[model samples]
Target: LVASGIDTNPWCDEAKKQKKGDNKSRKDVPTDAATAAPSIKSHSDFAEDTATEDSDATKESLASSFGKIVLWMGVVAVLAALHVYMSTPLTRGQVVPPGAWLSYCGLLPFDPECENAYLNVNFEGKVIAYNSNRDVAWEMQGDVCAAQVGSCVRGLELRDNGLIFVGGKRIRSIRVPDKSVSITPWPFAEKPHLKISRK
Candidate 1:
């Protein structure tokens, strides 16, 4: 056996086993995978998720903004239509202005053809009232005309809630519209004679 150059030591098998165990231990010490924690995600995957969320949020914001804009536009359009309608002469009753409804309108002989009918009263008087506290009480002076005559109305001395003495005639069931008469003693200070109230 010595001439063949083969040495048979009894501890040689034990040494080989120990070397294998060391190799196994080294292999058990895990690779670089220890740096990758379980909770960690790749940058590309996180960016994709973030981009998707942003896209959804942007879409929602744009939709909400667009909806608000449309709503306001509709409101503005309606208001514009109403303003135009109110400003046009259609609601003016041809000769009467806005903010008043009258009973009748009469024209004087030399009055302009297109004058505000509610502005051309032909009677004159003053309005006085009693407030119970009595100190000469409530008083207003303005001219008034009757709707009895379509051509002209007579003037007279008058008091509010009192009497109308025109040509010594007793006036009954008389109604006056606002802004359509002059309760002063003037030739043109009369009330309009239009059928504003439904009879």
Candidate 2:
């Protein structure tokens, strides 16, 4: 009872159910056009999230500039150790006077082998004496032969009959000889026996 060839067609079952519904609507129309649109990510995940937010904002701006350069290097090492502790120098306190210090300095030639002299004083009131070979030297500045001599410098003597200079309460004389220094009344001159000659 075959109709001569074989076309059991009911429209070929309705065109095989319309080609299986067009292959299930072409696989659900590309999954519904890839779930209908938006998702876009891959350029390496948006360049790795913009390089991890610019490496966490460059590590928080290099930890805020290394904490302000370690707090300005501890304030410049405490101002260079307080400027080397106030420019150093005044070595441990001072107070001097011992028979006005240099007792007999250079020439006391009334006798005593009559050797050249040598002496020196310190503690601010400088005085120096040298001879023998030091080309005869003498320097005076303060404690003029002490005796509580203060008032800025009130005492000095070198007498065989010459050079005496007391301060504050006055007492001066000068008559250096043997050819070296002389100041006959020329101590505080205004013509008080004014005369000074040295070579």
Candidate 3:
């Protein structure tokens, strides 16, 4: 202890030495541009690197997003294909109603030969009927009459010999007399219009 009640020892000397060392270290490291240039360049480099990383991340995210979109588009296309396949009409093992088959086939264009066969059909039972056509296959049922008249017009008698019936509803073929009973024109057809009356 000293007269001023202060400790005068090696510990006090160490404190003074630490203060001097701190000041000297600060002076040794310059606060000017010359010393700060490296640090400034380093900071700029860090910023540039961060920007590059962000750009890469953005590109990766976009690629991932694009991949997802493509996958969804593929899924949509597959669903559409499935829908078309399921919606198509079937024959034989697949049974379609009389009216639905008619409407569906009517939308498709008919063969010229098929239409031409009926051009000269004027007599009774002369209508050439078909179960299957280029556009549709039908399971026919019930008697067909002209849209104008509910019954057989033009003296067209539906006899057993004139119409070839299998299971009653299905008509295999039609036979017509050489002469028509009436002079009126009748609209009769095969497949869609050659309607057979179910017994």
Top-TM-score candidate index: 1
TM-score of each: 0.31, 0.27, 0.30
| CA deviation > 4 Å runs, candidate 3 | 1-41, 91-199
The lDDT per prediction is 0.42, 0.45, 0.42
Model 2 misplaced stretches (Cα beyond 4 Å): 1-5, 9-18, 21-27, 30-59, 90-199
lDDT minimum window of 10 residues, candidate 3: 116-125
Q: Give me the displacement of residue 120 in model 3, in angstroms.
A: 40
RMSD of 2: 18.2
| CA shift of 83, model 2, Å | 3.5
Q: Which one wins by lDDT: 2 or 3?
A: 2
- Candidate 3 lDDT, 94-198, residue by residue in tens: 222222212222323264433311111122323232233332122223344455764333322334233432222345433333232211121222222233333
lDDT of 2: 0.45
Cα lDDT of model 1 by residue, 50-85, tens digit: 999999999999999999999999998986665443
Error (Å) of candidate 2 at residue 102 is: 31
